[model samples]
Target chain A: MATSIRFDPIRLPPETEVLRGEVRAFLAEEIAAGGFDPRGGYAAERFDRSFSRKVGAKGWIGMTWPRQYGGHERSFLERYVVTEEMLLAGAPTRGHFVADRQSGPILLRHAPEDIKQDILPRITAGECTFCIGMSEPDSGSDLFAAKTRAEPVDDGWRINGRKVWTSSAHYADYMIGLFRTSAPADDNRRHGLTQFLVDLKAPGITIRPIQFPTGKHDFNEVVFDDLILPADHVLGEVDMAWKQATSELAYERSGPERFLETIEVLIELVRVLGAAPDSRGSEGIGRLVAQLHTLRRMSISVAGMLAAGEEPMLQAAMVKDLGTNWEQALPGLARDLAAFADSSPTNRATFDSVIQNATAVAPKLTIQGGTTEVLRGIIARGLGLR
Target chain B: MAEADTIVVDVATRIFQDLGDPQTVNNAGDDSWRAPLWQALTDSGLTLAWVPETAGGSGGARADGFAVLGLAGAHAVTLPLAETLLGGWLLAESGLEAPQGPIAVAPTRHQDRLTLAQDGTLAGTACQVPFARDCDSLALAAEGADGPVVALVAGHDCAIRPGLNLAGEAKDDVIFDGARPRLIAPAGADRDALMLMGAAARAMQMAGALQTLLDLSVRYAGERKAFGRPIAKFQVIQHDLARLAGETAAAVAAANSAGAAIEASERVDAGLLLDVAAAKIRVGEAAGTGAAIAHQVHGAIGYTKEHILHRFTHRLWSWRDDFGPESVWATRLGESVAAAGADELWPTITAA
Candidate 1:
């Protein structure tokens, strides 16, 4: 069978250039105002509500959504430009990044009208934050193994289980969690999982900090102890979260954030290498730049596919598989190339610090947003191999 | 690709399918198939597809020629179609008429240079001149007293010592010892420009070969069984094929972007250089990784000389070395990016 992978070379339209300029200017202003340090990754990992609100004020959040929900109703390409610029500038986007990237779109598609009216505007205004509750104590990549149960209680369901590796759960206003509503059918293990919109401030929920090896408190162990949710909080089908989950991942997996997470290291690499770098340094920089350009083009092509309303799941998985691997490798590559740099270059300290942080953070690039193994499996299915 | 470009690719695909099927060529024990394939390509005006109508060649768009090369790559045709097309384009660049038979360009390597004597003779030794032994003429880009000049010289005037690439194609060294040219004119492009063009051509070809590899690996995985089921049922093999597909997509995307930029630009500029260099480097990387994975998925059958997998993989390896290897291009591109400073990196990439 012909390979289904299609990355038709899609160029961003001219309008994107305008949006990019505005984004750069705004990011420059924010950096100047000491909102975040562009050279450091520490600011990037932190959830800054004020910074998110400012970004929302610029009408960048929920950019592609309808105007009625505080969105500008822009094209995906325009949103693409804004997202990439924010990523490259190291702007503190963690507060609204998840909501803007996937949660808002998921809600717009599957949430009830009242819920949408209540939450979409808050998300667009950067007044609300979202944390995904997919991974659990026993289930990570095998999402169907999730045992977090949601039992019917009075006018709602009570969720009683734990979700591990939940990013931003401690600070999030809500969580779109997956809970087991029924037993799996004989042939379909992926059956019976239901999605629910749970208010994080509700009773009987505990958010314990799960520190990464980098000593970053970006992840949380969220335990739900009979957490009550209204009946209308159920998203999409009652026992079919799997169906609702598959389509939204393409948006999550194929964004610029997938690849540009550690781009500061590359920028630091160039700074350390100087203008007339040695052959080894120059070649290393060149190869990385080339790979980065290729990944961006592929990512942008996927974005264009999304804009055209195509579900390019295989293509999206491929981009993430390659993109994450490349970004993860950047730190080591940068270290090797920078080894010969003058020990006292002007930004040598900054370069060393960035590389150190990137090294510690690189391990999660492949694991956090669906592990490499999971994505490859999805791609394999797309290739008709399974 | 545009609709018109698709038509051009379709035409080339049809020609290759009818005469240059890889399996058919692999099984044939003689040189009987080469003649007809070359004849079909020549009659279709694809050999000189890049040359303008005024230059005594087909007046097709540059993008169309690139698409044809990509098709030639997918088929892994042994004929010197890309070489001939490149040579004709070089001749046409100097306002010279392309000859009727196949032609090869000199100084395929960046360091190899041809010099023009005051007496108007071409003098240089060009190494790794693809298909030089088989070509009827040589398109020489010689450094003249005024500047670089493109000279058309008959192949017989030069001494050709033939060599073979990893794929066993002719990669000869041509020694032009004061060879007189039939026609000579000032070349508008420089050595770098020619190298960029050649790199773009090779990148497109590699992309096509990668596509073929992905298809072959997937098809093989589906049919070949190991433990009571098709090997494709295994997760590891499936992941291998998936990774190959990703590499193949990267190669295609990078090569197509470069080709599109070249077609859209009126002249070769720094922006075009960035696109071409990135394409060459990224596609070359894909070729190496993709080929290894394809062979791994295919097992011993793919490793056998009798298998058609070797044809594409060998050529993928060989093409990466042509028009400068990935390291060389990466080094150049890196230096340029560094010279532009760190801030310009994003702007440079976006421009590409």
Candidate 2:
């Protein structure tokens, strides 16, 4: 595909329809043998370790990674295919997702050789998982203003600080963290920060789950009470955490997942409409269907840019901001449509679940990733407004 | 390609920037919000743009026209430019010379009955005609059991009960009672198809209008001061204006993509319809946000009809509900996707 989308549509050469038979069989075996539920729990957010390993064993995990790293070396489009299937199945890929999709790559490019060789293979094999630790007490959007300090001590460093909004910190084995290694207020706020690979089991580190109003333990507050790390744990270079953190964020923030989150409710709304939807429903369904498709293309295009290593920051922001609205609307609209009833039980259940989830966390979608305001600020800058 | 597209948008920007010029907008009253500017557009082949060269038209595409009109909408043009352009094209395409001056074709289904006398005298009455008094000719749907016919009746032919659209465009309850009708196109034609075209035109125009309101409101927020600094310096206003700008941009971009696809295909694609509907939803959303944001930015002046901000906001406030609301489109889109399921979804979605 040409770099710019003008007349032609993009055909991601690697995309496959994702055969249901194969996925079903693999999932069946995992359910029967690995003993996992497709819908794990009420608010299942953790990655199923045994299930993930089984999936990784099935050559599903890191399908897009290079073969040398114990991966199938499938294309990003192929990875997208697998991802959509997993989400639709409500499978627990969350554990390895960060590692397989994001961190492993971050390590490959910026991590020291020892860390990459050790972590990447384990991640691909589903033997390891990683959590992100960036946001601090006082620093949210101004993340570079991190107050977490690390002092060089002999052949290692001692770290002391608190981190909030650290989701999955309780379950992950390793954390990709940003700690201030230099003195306060370095001239280059961007450079004073440094990323470190911290072992979650390290001494003097405490993890406390912050229960949301929804009673979900998805996010946690973790504190480091002078935890020690070896010299080799540093990613990239000392006082260069900002660059590594930036790359990790670009990976975390943009993806097909961002836009596809609300699709469950969307599909449910359609199924309830039955074979022949009334003209009113048809208009509404048709419009959403079209937007989902258009945004998917735009997002896939962004993913392609990432696959080729282009820093399409503004484009990603555009997708996320627009994607946020679609994601948020899924629940409220589903509830309204479902209120009509007369839908099949399966359709109702699907709609009900999606609505429940959507209603609970729709507000977070805007605030998470990045607030709507921040994304627009980025977009305005892209449009040369600032 | 992106750069060139930006340049086209730049042309629109230039048009809006000229609004402060002594351009007889206030005098156009409801219709002349920016008449001189629109006239400039016509001179530049912006109006009558959807017509083809084969029929003495601008030979320009509707999507291009949509882009231009969006800017015109942003500038708060007083006249019913889209109705005229699209309605005129329908008449011209139906083998009728368009009304040369100030015309508004219904561009809607109407046609209770059309009867022909032995002397080739055509007569019929349409239920309702848009901007009827403002139009020199009215293009309406002539009644047909099989399918509706395109009947272009001279404005003088019908006894019109003129009224106003919610935003003040002239709407008339047109009575063709024993009146002569110019048979433009045959009966039993594709009303559904033509309506889609008309709808597409309306959606693009509305999208433009919403976009203008959003831009103006954001600019106001940035320039207008409250307390100490520009009001935009506050996080709340910034957030509101930012959201308005983002969603409006999305709507504009979405509509542009659909319009481009339609222009490329030349035939109505199901996917294109989906795109058009989605654009409608976004346009409505932008209008809601845009109007509210505009009002908030303009503060007290926005509520007063005397203020120029109301000119843009009023159009946005009304146009947002016209055609359809976002909820309507959302449900439609949900249905289309559900009908497709997982297998058909990839191709249907990725196709566009």
Candidate 3:
């Protein structure tokens, strides 16, 4: 059994807090150049294609990736520097996140040669966007039961079934879906499934945007009604979709983004409170600040683990499970802090909108990667209990 | 501060775990409530871990002794371990070095000047004293012209009027009208350190108690079956448990870091107070959650005194409300963290 993870804190070469300033300058220029509003912060998908391309050109995207993949070959800490800057700036980076962080690396390690050659440069140049198609109606936390079948055809495969919660499908280029290849067996039903890169514009692929509890089209239910795919589009080895999917999840679950999802509002709340604090506001915000710092450290530690070539599934799970709360709690905390005194309708309306749109989604945070119970069970098993 | 502290924590944790299952404690039918565990601690020299090494004590850091007290909390073993270690240390630091056996201190806060004579007299009453009945000696924090002075006296050296809390832990109204006593530390010897040290110790205890209830609730969720399956298999139960574990970890981290920081710091000032306050608030919130969730997980079984879960959960609820509840710290911490030139009310809220 693997032992409990004891992380020694990573000490950075103590740099000036002015690193924040440098990032702000770059983002301010980008925002002005592209006319992005602060209201949406990073959530609006106001993604400037040219701006992202420039950022990538500046050796920011794939900053920590290997030089062989047209990356800068910087350390994970260095990439952290870039990420923190972008987030602090509230720059829209999600469009390039999956491709740069997960799919690009997945291509490097396991994707076939032709597939790697086709996707790596596009991702590095921030020209391509990839959305995950792992969750489905009947099979979300339990993706093994997903009925999305990919029957072998003449040249490639004929896929039929539905995928739910594809976030960027309305605007995305392609989708990476986990498809079942063969009938279930006693040994392992999970083994027959494989990941295939499907073109969003392909025939017989129906993309219906699913309006969520909040009136947002951030998700869609995409159906594959006999959509055909070339044999070359399969990601990694056939019948090894679980491994690839898990790896993608590890990337999504381990990033600084997990904790920073609603941090914009948090900082805004702090800014609104101003430098001087009322007695109640000071203590409430201090606790939140301390909690945020701890989560950031844990998330950074998870990143460090990933950097060292460790899966750290449980550690990552811990970070996501806890990080989700901070995201969900942001609006509520903002409201609570402002409740004691005078608060403008503008901030209240904004906070209400966020709460309406995000809080219900917060519970899904743990469910997205794996359920909290599942993580705890895994942790307990790691601790050697039955 | 030393590597051995980790070893001590490991040892203390193991001993507490071996003894913690309150189920066994309840089933054993031992009502006298003597702790073989406390004796084990005495044997391990944990009792003297915080006592001054100069005053015939094996003094280490305050966290050294407090960590052990935290172990006692985790095990749900109630034997006044913190009270005595803190009390004995107060006594030792008072230049008394007089507590030979298990001695507990009730540090009282009195407004009037304590009339101390060469014959060791302690006069006047101290409000908001904890564990007064359980303590052997009273560590009175007498108000001096400069600051609060700490002194120790026999429990019965003053009147022992009974007082109590919701938890079964005994308390008494401690009165000393010119009753004889011995001086511990001189006035103005960094009572702030003692206060921060206390916060650190209490935070650890509350953190441990939170974990204890977290474990109890999780175990209940796993073993107690409903609808022909373990209730833990449900998504809602899973979510609850996940939230519980997350909060427990936060509390542990806060308390753990605060204890470490208190140990590392040379002085306990506003920053230390803020850290301790933060730890205390988190631990208090964590304890409440643990208590609430343990009951929810246990369903009807938790409400009965017969169940061992109540033993731990009840203690958590009790301790959480004491020592200035979470909101109290919230206001204080809020003011402490406020940028200068802030509201006058902020400072007023933190006047103590």
lDDT of 2 by residue, A89-108 (tens): 55777778778767777777
lDDT of 3 by residue, B1-352 (tens): 3323787888777766676557777677664446576677777767777677677666767667767866677777766677677766665655666465566444432122354444455666554456777666666555444445677777767887777656676655666876766554574334444555666677778777777777777777778899999887776776666566666666776676676656666655565665577677777777777677668878998888788887777777766644456676666666554454223222221221
Q: Specify the CAPRI tier of model 3.
A: incorrect
lDDT of each: 0.88, 0.65, 0.66
For all predictions in the order shown, the interface RMSD in Å is 1.1, 6.4, 6.1
- Name the candidate that leads on lDDT: 1
At residue B9, give the lDDT of candidate 3. 80
Against the true structure, candidate 3 has what lDDT?
Answer: 0.66
As for lDDT, the candidate ahead, 1 or 2, is 1
**lDDT by residue (tens digit), candidate 2, B160-225:** 787766667665667766666665565322344445455556566666666556556666666777
Cα deviation in Å at residue A70, candidate 2? Answer: 6.9
Each candidate: how many clashes? 0, 23, 6
Q: Write the per-residue lDDT of candidate 1 for residues A204-287, one digit (tens) a residue.
A: 899999998867787899999988899999888988887875557998899988889879899889988988899999999999
How good is model 1 by TM-score? 0.98
Q: Please give the lDDT score at residue A68 for candidate 3.
A: 68
Residue A103 Cα positional deviation in candidate 3, in Å, after optimal superposition: 2.6
| True-structure RMSD, every candidate | 1.5, 5.6, 5.7
Residue A84, candidate 3: C-alpha displacement in angstroms: 4.9
